[model samples]
Target: MSAGAVADWLGVACLVAGGLLSLAAGIGVLRFPDVLDRMHAATKPQVLGVLLMLAGVALRLRTTSDIGMIVLVAVFQLTTAPVAAQMIGRAAYRSGRVDRSLLDVDELAEER
Candidate 1:
């Protein structure tokens, strides 16, 4: 009934949701048929999962310095994940791991 208890419960809920998202990402990576799909599965849910986990940690810690560090980590994860996924996708495309038939727009096709 207290505010502190509410915060704790919220944090625990976030952690559980994050864990589920991470598990979904793992399953998606394993079940997806190709590189692009796999990368999609790996990046989207994984980033969300990490962010959620960090949010849970931040909520639980509830200190300025710790919260700042968590924010920094979340920012880093958000920034790097997409870039890394783009690189991986490009690599997969160049190496012929991507299925062209599934592509509705092949913008990169003109680049090469």
Candidate 2:
């Protein structure tokens, strides 16, 4: 009917989509059967989901402070999530918990 109504609907939809993506990521973590797959799902989708949620909230609020906070949060997530995921992957690798079926074997050991 009105632009406001449409915007509200869109905001709600964004939040719902974010929620669903987050749920999917969680399910992927539980269902993927390996750490590599879990990382693949958790890192990307979680970042996207958080961004979507911030977008929805920012759009719904439509205030300068809210927008600023949303931007800060999105930036924080964009920066930290990848670093965290990389750390987890590296930790897993150093500790020898990888999916060998999906990749080439480590040759360093053989060379040594």
Candidate 2 Cα RMSD (Å) = 2.1
lDDT per residue, candidate 1, 1-112, as tens digits? 9988899989999999999999999999999999999999999999999889988888788999999999999999999999999999999999998889899999889674
- Inter-residue clash pairs, candidate 1: none
Write down the lDDT of every candidate, Cα atoms only: 0.93, 0.86
lDDT of 2 at 1: 100
Candidate maximizing lDDT: 1
Looking at candidate 2, the ten consecutive residues that score lowest on lDDT are 103-112
